[model samples]
Target chain A: MRVGVVTFPGSLDDVDARRAVTLTGGEAVSLWHASDSLQGVDAVILPGGFSYGDYLRCGAIARFSPVMAEVIKAAHAGLPVLGICNGFQVLCEAHLLPGALIRSDRRTFYCKDQDLRVESTDTVWSNAFTPGQQINIIIKHGEGNYQADAETVKMLEDENRVVFRYINGNPNGSLHDIAGITNERGNVVGLMPHPEHNVDPVTAPTRDGIGFFESLARYLGALASRTQGGTA
Target chain B: MAKIIVDVMPKPEILDPQGKAITGSLARLGYSGLSVRQGKRFEIEVDGEITPERLEQATQAADSLLANTTIENYVVRVDQ
Candidate 1:
């Protein structure tokens, strides 16, 4: 399976994201923010970093990049997309996902190995884990606190869109302690955690982060098989 | 001409630890009478030639970039 990792200016995690994809047995393609093409990759990953120097708000300027235009369109067409940390900020800024990320409740940048519960395994990117499974991943950001209105939160919960929640503690005072979420179609997932950094056992807080990349690879492989059979 | 003010605040569901810490400090400092809530505000100016619809679009543009809808709420006003 081929996965594209987009590199926006100031993106710090693109290399890590690509490495994770390669380690998971998928081809990692480099994509530029200025391009509107997906390079025919089966899925896309928006890595983390202070895109556009977090100027005019985090992920705000990055959302208007040419690549995001294509990403938004492909995501709507059921192409799997995963946004991590600042990528999550970009997703929300682009309105591809609901809610927003603000400064942490403590008004301090947070960085640590975080425990998160797998709330939904139905998403294309989360199918490797069972629902309710707890795993550790790294989270680093100043504006990682997630918030949304009560009605919207209720709606997301009812629709099973809440994909991940903080297990040990509320790191950033996220509403409902949410750590990650999926779109209604379950193809687009966004979270303020650095799963890419945890894919390798040597570098990972634990081996838990590999599940994310492995899950996406498995899903894409299955999709390829289905397509081949249909063509035959 | 039209003017819009947007106020962004963390929703009530999420605890504002910073605010709490500030309030605690205030109490410790004997400024216990102060109540504090943390948020962001924006003042936008639009030209008179811009229609209400156009101004609303501009406001939305600024809001999506300047305000995070997940953690912040925004309100807009027009002045003639």
Candidate 2:
């Protein structure tokens, strides 16, 4: 399976995301933010970083990049997309996902290996884990707090769109201690933690992060085979 | 001309430590009954020639760029 990792100006985690893809037995393609094409990759991952220096707002300017135009379209067409940390910010900014990320209540940058519960495993990116599984991933950000209105929050809970939740403690003040979410179709996933950084056991807080990439590979590989059979 | 107002706030589920700290400070200062939640507001001026589509585009721009949706909520209104 081939996965594309988009690199926007100021994106810090693109390399790590690509490495994670490669380690998971998939081809990692480099995509530029200024490019309009997706390079025909089966899936896409928007890595984290202070895109556009987080000047106007985190992930704000990055959302307007040319690549996002294609990403938004492909995502709607059932392409799997995963946004991590600042990537999550960009997803929300681009309206692919709902809610917002704000500064933490601590009002300071947070950095730690976070424990999270895999609340929903139905998403393509999270299918490797069972519901209620505990995983450790790194999180680093200043404005990682997630928020939404009462009605919207209720809807997310009711629809089981809430994908991940803080297991140990609220690291960034996310609503309902939400650490991640998936779109209604379960194809697009966004999370505040850095699973890419945790794919390697030597560097990861734990080996749990590999499940995310492995899951995506397995799903996309199956999808590719299905397409081939249909064509035959 | 059209006037647009934008209001932004942290989602209620997310904890607002900054707002709480401010509330604490206010209580210390003897402003006992004051309630505060931190957020942002923007007032924009639009030309009368702007179409509703264009207005919506501008609002989306404001939402995507000017506002942080992860921790903020925005409401837009156009005043005649």
TM-score result, candidate 2: 0.83
Quote the lDDT for A200 in model 2. Answer: 76
Q: Write the per-residue lDDT of candidate 2 for residues B1-77, one digit (tens) a residue.
A: 56777777766755667778899899999999887777777777776766788679777966656666555667776
User: For residues A1-232, what per-residue lDDT tens digits would candidate 1 score against the true structure?
Assistant: 8899999999999999999889878899999999999999999999999999998678989999999999999999999999999999888888888887877877778889999999999999899999899899998988888878789889889998999999878987788999899898989999998889987878866978888987887888798899999999
Docking class of 1: medium
Model 2 spans with C-alpha error above 4 angstroms: B1-64, B68-80
- Give me candidate 1's interface root-mean-square deviation: 3.0
TM-score for each prediction? 0.86, 0.83
DockQ of 2: 0.51
Which candidate tops TM-score?
A: 1
A91-154 per-residue lDDT for model 2 (tens digits) = 9888898887878877889899988999898999899999999888898988888878788789
Give the per-residue lDDT of model 1 (tens digit) for B9-77.
Answer: 756655666677788889999997887777666676766655779667856864666666566556665
User: Where is the poorest 10-residue window by lDDT in model 2 chain A?
Assistant: A199-208
